[model samples]
Target: MATGDEIWEALADFTEQCNNNKRLRKMQRDWTKILHFKAIDMDDSFTMKVVEGEIVKNDKGTVGTPDIIVETDSETMCDMFWGDINPTQKYLRGEIKVKGTQEDVMRIDVITAVIWPEV
Candidate 1:
């Protein structure tokens, strides 16, 4: 299992990669939202905000009422950020729980797909 710090680092890298992807930038052009992630196992939480096609990480706990709330273990969170795991598959298997509008959920999936295309 990844530690809390490892998960944070992975998320940082993930956001950096997402920001650098033109397709992702175009996809999120007008979308602005905050996503709060709760690492259940670690009892830690972090927030990510998407504004003006850029992903900004805020590891200082919940910033505001997040548009999306994702609950999962630290290891899974790290794996997903590293593109080593498919979040949709995990969600389907009931390993990850998400609270948000369908569109927002799909947006998360889109980001994941763009970051780590299926092989």
Candidate 2:
């Protein structure tokens, strides 16, 4: 199990990497979204807000209405954000659960693929 702090740190790093990537920015240029991530094995939830491809807010707790909600173990989340695991594979293996419109889900998957191409 990973601590909440670890997850937060990983999220921070993930956001930084995404924001720094030219291709990711171009791809997400028009994608504005609010996502809620819950750690199923722990009492922790995080919200990430993206606007014009930039992650404007990423912090503990749910901040607003979610366009997407994803649930998984804390460690898995940390691993995914740290580019240590492929989130799509985790979802396929039933390790991650996502509730959202098909478009939103696909968008998240695209983000993961771009961020962690080797994973």
Q: Which pairs clash (backbone N, Cα, C closer than 3 Å) in model 1?
A: none
For all predicted structures, in order, the TM-scores are 0.94, 0.97
User: Candidate 1 on 56-109: residue-level lDDT in tens?
Assistant: 656657888899999998888999989999899999998999999999888889
**Residue 56's lDDT in candidate 2:** 94
Global lDDT of each model? 0.87, 0.93
**What C-alpha lDDT, on a 0 to 100 scale, does residue 70 get in candidate 2?**
96
lDDT of 2 by residue, 4-35 (tens): 99999999999999999899899999999999
Highest lDDT model number: 2
